[model samples]
Every structure is written in C-alpha cells, then in structure tokens.
Target: MSSAAAAVSAKPANSRSRVLLASLVGTTIEFYDFYVYATAAVLVFPHLFFPTGNETTALLSSFAVFGAAMVARPLGAVFFGHLGDRMGRKTTLVAALLTMGIATFLIGLLPTYAVAGWLAPALLVILRLAQGFALGGEWSGAALVATENAPQGKRALFGTFPQLGAPIGFIIANGLFLIIAALLPSDDPSRPSLAFLDWGWRIPFLFSAVMVIIGLWVRLNLVESNAFEKTVKTGQVRKVPLVTAFQNNFRELVLGTFYMLATYVLFYLMTTFSLSYGRAAIDAAVPGLGYDYTTFVLMMIIGVVFFGIFTLVSGPWADRFGRRKTLIWVTLAIALFGLCWVPMLAEGLVGVMAWLIIGFTLMGLTFGPMGALLPELFPANVRYTGSGISYNVSSILGAALAPFVAVALWSAGDGSPFWVGVYLTAMAVITLIALLLGRETRDIDIEE
Candidate 1:
C-alpha cells in the first residue's frame, strides 16, 4: 500500500484500538463498582445493615437493596442516553465515570447499622441508585464506541472487547473480596472474624476511587465515536434521542430488551444467587451448602476466568456466524445448562464448580455479541437512546428480580433448586424466540 493510504488506514485502526481500550477500562471500573455491592450484599450487608432479621430475612433484605438498583437503571438509561445521543459518547461516559466514582467512594465512608441504624441501609440504597444511573449511560456509550469504530464485518469482535469488562470486573471485584475475606479469618466456634463484616468490607468500596481515576484517565483520552461524528456531519442528530428512539426504533428496542433477558437472568443466577446458596449454613433455618465464603468466592472467580475467555471468543464467532444465529444456539445451550443446575449443585463443591463453569461459559457466549447487536438495531442518531433503554429495561425485567425471585422460587420448591432451573430455561426460550423473530443484525450496515 502507498504511504498515504497506509497512514489514513492506520489512523482509524489506532482510534479503534483506543476506543476498545477505553471501553474495557471504563466498563471494568463501572462493573467493579457495581458488583462490589452485589458481593457485599451477599457477604456483609445482611449482617451489617439489616441486623433486625433472621439469617433468611437479612439475606433477603440485602438482595432487595441489591435489586433496587435495577429499578433505577432504566431511568439512568433515559438520562444518560439522552446526553450520549445529544452531546457525544465520550463526554457522557466521562460523566458516568465521575458519578459512579463519587457515589461508590461515598459508600465506603458510610456508617454501619451500629453507628447509624436504619439510615445506613437507606443511604446505601441511594448510592446504589446512583451507580445504576451512571451505568445506564456507560454501557451503550462503551459498546458504541467500540462497535462503531470497528472495522467492517468485525463489529461483533470489536463489540466483545467492551463486554470483556464484565468478567474482568467480576474477577477483580471477587478477587479483592476473597483476599480481604482471607485477611479477616473464618468463623469458628471459639473465635470468629467479625472483622470482615465490621470494616474489611469497606475496603473494596473505598478502593473504587483508584479504579475511577484510572478509568477517567483512559476515557478522557478517547474521541467521540465515528458513528456519532458522521451523524453530526450529516446534521441528522436527533433533537430528542429518547423520543426519536421510541417513535422510530420501537421494534428493535423491544427485540433488544428480550434479547438481553437470557444473559441477565443467567448471570445473576450464577453469580449472586449461587453465592447465597453456597454460603448458607447447612443447619440454619433455611438450607444451603454451608461452604466457606473465601473458598466459594475463589471458585466463582475461577469460573469468571472462563467467562472472560469465552467472551473474547464469542466476538469472532458472532462476526462470522451472525448475531441472531449465535444467540439462538448459545441460548439453547444455556437452557440445557439450566436443566443441570439441580444435579450439579447437588454434587457439592465439585458440582457447584461444574455448574458455574457451564453457566458462565454460556453467559459469555450470549452476552458477548450484545455490544454489537444492540447498536446495530438502531440508527446512529438514536442508537445510544434505543440501546440504553432496551438494555436497562431488560435489567429490570431480568436481573432486578432474579436473586430475589430465585430465592423465592427456591423456597416455594421446598428448598429444591428445580423451580429456579425452570425459570432460567424459560428465560432462555424467550430470548431464543426473540432472536428468531428479530432482525439478522450481522449484515446490517452500521452506517445506516
């Protein structure tokens, strides 16, 4: 190639690399900040915040608070989506980083129930809502930044770059928790490590400041997405992206919401619900595996390692095979995997390990292509708004209630995991139907 041609090509290629890097870094922090709460909810919040309840009640209440974030995610979607579609992905994402950073760091500084009583949980709810709001705009912008800047025919591969942040975030958050959990010592008949609950947990939330600073540095260096730039150049940027998305892109919006359901439901069931199930005291009023916290969390981290690897692999497969086809098949695998939940968890730690590996592998396969598929469903003018709405709406429909619902389902089944498995399979089927009926996004011109 001529020097001039190579230079021009190299510019976009380099920009795409930066977009992917920024997306990975920013989303890693976003999810790390977010999942730190999920981890804490299971590990400490019940004991620290809701001291008034039985173990069952305390765990349920913490999950209730955890789920509350999903309630506000759609609102964040609207607010940030508007800013993203109106202003630009870069500015909106940077703002999201700052908002999440400030909120999460504040969470570390909050007093526990012993010091502040009911006020502690109340403040936690407020901060969790803020995290939801920040994430509302973060995912769409990151996905669009990566996918829109992607080279032709490789949108799925590029899109998965941002999705990789999920597993990476999971690893970091869980690894830190595990390390800190180890420092505090385990509960024993003679002496217990109340330190983990007393103050050790706060260390994770407090550390979010560092993650935010790093994320902001990377995001600040990023340019606006090429798709948004072209929309601006064409003078076709919508005056009201949210409204335009609803009016013009309703079908794709709906399809994208259902398309995400399988991923969200399976994710929480694997990560959050399983933690509760595994860590419960077997002889307690409510039955659980009674595993140690650090061990179970370490297992979860190992499973997430596989989750991270498959996320990268799914990108290339989605690019080659098409998003709809990949989703339908991988979701079927999820359904099959769901049916094995009872048998696997029944196997003790080994079974639990098997279940998580299978569940997370399937989660990666279904989740990876979303960054490309969601954005491709909308026009550039409202892509942020449409994808944000659909993605967070799915959160409400899927994850917001998953742990709470799974617990309820487990209770309703008389302590069996059967009903939860049915629920997962049902969600996968719904997602499969959504994919079959939705647009074949792989061939869609992103520039459209």
Candidate 2:
C-alpha cells in the first residue's frame, strides 16, 4: 500500500472516552427532547393545545398528536439512514440533533389553542412530526457509533452508555419540570398554577437548545468508525441503503422490529401512561391513584434511578451471557411483571412505587442490549438503514400506540388498569417469540 493509504488504514481508533461521550451525549439530548414532549403531552398540552370541553377527550386528543409523531419516525429513518450510510454517521447524527432541537425549541414558542385556534394544534403536530423524524435517525446512528468502535468482547457494555441516555434524559426532563412547577406553586395541589400551565412547561423545551449545542460539539469531533471506514475502503457502501437493507435483510428487519416491541411498550407505559394515571383526580369520571403531579413525578424519578442503575448492570450481564439469552430472561420477567400491574397498582403508594421500580428495571435490561443487538443484525454498508428502520418501526408499533391503548383500556376497565397490564403482557409475548426465533447477535461480526 502507498504510505498515505497505509496511514489512513492504520489510523488509531477513536479514544474510548470520545466514542462513549459522543454516543451518550447525542442520545441524551435526543431523548431529553423526546421526554420533554412526553411530560408535556400529559401535563400541559391537553390544557393548552386541545381545549376540548371534556377532560378525557382533551387528553386523548393530546395523545393522538403525541402518537402522530411516530408515523413520521419511519420516514425519518429512511431519509437520515440513507445519509448515515452514504455520507457518514457523524454528519447524519448532527443533522438529526439539530432537527430535534429546533422542533423542541419551537414547541416552546407556539401559541395555545385560545390564541391560534386550529392553527395551534396544527403547528404542534408539525413540530412533533419533526421531532419524530429527527429521532428516527438518532438512536441507530448512536448505536452504530458506539458498537462499531467498541473494543473486542465489550460491544454490549459500550452499548449501555447510549442506552443510559433514556433514563438520564427522563430524570433531567422531569426534574426541570418539577423545579419549574415548584417555583409556580398552585393554590390547589390537584391543579397546576395558571402561571405554570401558561409558561413554566416551556422552559424544558426551550432548554433543549443548549443541550443540542453541546451534543453537536461532541459529535462534530467524532471521526467515522473504523468499520464504516472499511466499508468505504472496500467499495462496499451502497448507493441506496434503505432499498438494499430491505432487499437483503428483510428477515432481520422484521425480527428486529418485533424484538423491540416489549421494551417500547413497557417504557411508554411506565413513563407516559403511569404519569397520567397516577396524577388524575380520584373523583373524576375515571378515577386514578389520585396523587398530585409533582408527587407522582418524584416517585417516577426515584424509579428511573433504578432504571439507570439496571441499565448499566444489564450490559455486563449481556456480555457475560449472550444478548439473546439475557434478553430472553428479561423478557420473561417483563411478561410476569405485566401480570402484576393490577395488584401492585391497586395497593396504593407502596404498590405503585414497587411496580414502577420493577418495571423500569426490566426496561433497562431489555433496552441496554439493543444498542448492540440491532446494529449487529446488518452489515456495515446497510447497518444504519436496516437498524434505523427496525427501531423506528417498532416505535410505531409499540410506543406510538402504547399510551393511547393503555388509556383506552384504562377507561374500558372502568378505571381499572387490569386491561392495560394485559396489553403489556401481550406485547411481551410477541417480543419473546421474536427472540426465540432469532439468532444470538452477541457473536455476530457487525463490521462485515
């Protein structure tokens, strides 16, 4: 090889700190942006964006808009996935972060239903779609970056750093809201102060711009992964990665999508549905746990602390075992946890807290390994497109509808959460079956 070619080939891998930080920070910002919207969808949007005469109708409408974003995620995967495969993970990641940050920042500035009439909701949905679009590309790229650069036998452990972003983001997003709400104290604990409903919620959304800036700085410093560089050197980069992904790896696409089904459902149920269910008034048409919003969020934050801890723990377990085996045991536990939702949720504060802790712990286990597993399903040339499509498509199947379905089931059961638990169990079964049908990805050669 020419001296110049040799130098290019022999370049050292990204420093471990740089790889982990780039992956972790970008997803932290992305999930922070997403969780901010989720918290608002429950606490603020129904009151402002969809001011229907009835509370249930208003909440459902708000959730509908929240779910609408999932529809855009797959399209985002294709668009940004193509770019990641064709250009580089670094540039595509920057674009996704900017897109999500701008959308979230804009959400803070939007007029409410009273001021903008129908235009208010229209703008909200538009921005939500943009958020979904940006996120579609974000997770898969971050996963690829981490796992692709991972030291031998430690890919799953490296993968957990990115997965750590979800819990960290949830904590930060909800923590800001809690602080803001405290500042704008309410006369009645049951209802938000008018000032808070009017303005306090926007701070978290606006604050996302600062995070986006940091994420961009970290990502811009990232050199393309050695694996991706090899694809380029070997002339293996596909001109149309999305098409090639589907044509060549159709089975993996299907399996990966369903493989994530339980994790997505459990996560949204734990975070979004639980927030609404926990905080709704006891005397309302559909009674709930009757805790105030601030109290319930605090409880969730406590549970998410376990979520973060278990996320770190899961990586080593998956590495020691295999991803499929670790996830199988975790997935089974998730199914059993679903069955316990009703009894646990009915037992009042202790029960509810136990449920949250257990559920989020399982969420951590299932989610952490995916940062390695999904990227391992495809070769370097099409890994971005294939994995992005699977992850986002599962978002559509699992997350997009989980809150909506749980709400419907909650109402269907006359405020009982039994049916919602059943729904979770059902999704878990699908995921377990998918896991059983698929091969262990722990040993796969992702660079090929």
Candidate 3:
C-alpha cells in the first residue's frame, strides 16, 4: 500500500473514539431538534398552528402535520442514502444536519395560527417536512459511520454509541421543554398568556441553533468511515444505491421495517400519549404532583436515563447472544409492558413512573442492537439505502400514525386508555414475529 493509504488504514485507537463521539453527538443533536418538534406537536402545536373551531379538530390537525414529517422521511432517506453511498457518509450527514437545524430554528420563529391565519399552518407543515427529510438521512449515516468504524468483534457494542443518541436527544429535548414550562407562570387567566405562547415555546426551538453549531463543528472533524473507504478502494460503490438495495436486500429491508414497528409504537405512546394522559390526570386528581407539564417532563427525563443505560447494556449482550434473540426478548417485554399501560395509568404517579421505567428499559434493549443489525443484514454497497429506507418506512407505519391512532382509540372508547395499549401490543407482536423470522446478523462480515 502507498504511504498515504497505509496511514489512513492505520488510524490510532483514539481516532475511533473521536469518530464515535462525532457521530454520536451529531446524531443526538439531530434527534433532539427533531423530537422537540414532536413534543410541541403533542402539547402546543394544536393550539398554536391549528386553532380551529373545535378542540378535537385542532389536535387531530396537529398530529396530521406531525405525520407529514414521517411521510417525507423515506424520501429523504432515498435521496440522502444515495448521496452517502455514492459520495460519502460524512458529506451527507453534514448536509442533513444543516437542513434540520435551519428548519427547526425557523419553526421557532414562525407566527402562530392566532397571528397568521392559514399561512401559519402552511409554513409549519413545510418546515416539518424539511425536518423529517433531514432526519431521514441522518440516522442511517450516523449508524453506519459508528458501526463501520468499530473494531472487529465489537461492532454491536460500538454501534450502541450512535444508538445512544436517541435517548440522550430525548432527554435533552424533554428536559429543555420541562425547564421552560416550569419557568412559565402557572396558567392564570389574569396573567398575560404571552409568557408561554409568545416566548416560552420558542426557547426550546431556538435552542436548536446552538446544538446545530456544535453538531456541525463535531461532524466537520470526522473522517469517512474506514469501511466506506475500503469499499471505495475496491471500487464497490454503487451508482444507484436505492435500486441496488431494493433488488439485492429486499427481504432484509422488509424485515427491518417490521423489526422497528414495536419500538416506534412504544416511543409515541411513552412520549406523546403518556404526556397527555399524565398531564390531564394530574390536572384532575393530583395537583401537588407539581405542574402537570413539569411532571411529565421530569418523568420523560427519568425514562431517558434508563433508555440510555439499557441501550448500552444491550450492545454487549447482543454481541454475545445474537441480535435476533435480544430483539425478540425486548419485543416481548414491550408487549407485556403494553398490557400494563391501563393499570399503570390508573395508579397515578407511582404507576406512571413504573410504567415509564419498564417501557424505556425495553426500548433501550431493542433499540441498541438495531443500528448494527439492520446494516449487517445487507451488503455494504446497498447498506445505506437499505437501512435508511427500512428505518423510515417503519417510522411511517409505526410512529407516524401512533399519536393519531392512540388518540382515536382513546376517544373511541370513552376516554379509556386500554385501546392505546392494545395498539402498541399488536405492533410489538409484529416486531416479535419479524425478529423470529429473520436470520441473526450478529456475526455477519461488514464487507460481505
């Protein structure tokens, strides 16, 4: 090998750490920016963006707008996946993060329905679509970067760093919202409502600007993954990655979609439904639980901590035991946890806490190995497109409709939360079956 080529191939141990940190932190910020919008969609967007004549209509419309991002995600994945595979993962990720940050920052500045009529919602939808598109490209690039750079026999464990970003992002996103909400004066008819509407909400969204800058700085320093470099050296990069993924790895793509269903469903329930339920229940029964909004945020942060820990734990376990087995066990736990949702919801604060802890633990376990498992199932040439499409397609079927479906089910049953649990349970079962049917990819070679 040439001196330059040998130097590139002989990167020091610290290089991997630097690359992992860059990928993890960049993804965390991207997810944070993305999820902040999700939280707002559930809690505030209905009133701010779609203040129609009826409350139900407004809420439904907000969720509809939220779903718009999911719809755009697959498109983003295809476009960016192609770029990553054909161009380079680092280049694609930088572009994706910039797009997401700009969209989120703009969202903070948007005028509300109260101020701008239909134009407010129109602009919000456009921005939401932009957010989804950016996220679509972000996850696959980050995951591939982390996994591809990992040491042999440690791919699953190392991949967890990128996956860890999900929970960390959730923690930061919810924690920021919680802090801002707590600082807002209690909802008083006498006091100016502008405190929250005019400014408080914008704080969380505008915070993305700082995160985006940090992400850009970190991402700019990252080298292209060694695996991608190897692919380039072998002249194996595909000219049409999306088509190649579909043609060669269709089964893995389909299975990946199913594999992600349960986690996605659980995520929406824990973050969106649980928040709304906890807030409403607290408002009605236990005022001393602190502000309903604040309590919900704290609980979410608690869940986020467990989520990160469990994800880290799942990494080595998956590498040892196999991704399929780990996934099946986690899916079963999620299914069982779903069955406890109604009982837990009825038990007040303690019940909610137990529910979140259990749910997030399961989330961590299932989510941790997925980053490596999905990519391992496909060949390197199609890895980016295959994994990207599968992940976002699952997001559409599982997460995109979760809040909306959960709410509809809740309304259909006269306020009973049981139906929401049933929906989650069913999705978990789908994931369980998919994992059972899929081959274990734990030992798959990256360059295969």
Cα RMSD to the true fold for all candidates: 4.0, 1.9, 3.1
Clashing pairs in 3: none
Candidate 1 per-residue C-alpha lDDT over 160-250 given as tens digits, one digit per residue, 9 for 90 to 100: 9889989999889999987887778865621226887678888989999999888888887876655666677666777788888888888
lDDT of 3 at 242: 86
Give per-model TM-scores: 0.95, 0.97, 0.93
TM-score leader: 2
Clashes of 1: 0
Q: Write the per-residue lDDT of candidate 3 for residues 1-448, one digit (tens) a residue.
A: 2443354456543388676897799889888987898788867787678878665577778888888899999999999999988877778999999999999999999998889999999999999999999999999898898888788888889878888888989888888876776677656421224577678889888989999999898888777666776777677888899888888788889999999899888887777766655554323321112335665678778987999999999999998998899888888888888788778866867877888888888888988998888888888777888899999999899889998898788767666778788889999999988988899887777976
Question: Which residue pairs clash within candidate 2?
Answer: none
The per-model lDDT (C-alpha) reads 0.85, 0.92, 0.82
**Residue 156 of model 1, lDDT score:** 95
| Superposed model 1: Cα runs more than 4 Å off | 1-14, 189-192
Q: 70-131 in candidate 2: lDDT tens per residue?
A: 99999999999999998878889999999999999999999999999999999999999999
Q: What is the lDDT of residue 205 in candidate 1?
A: 93
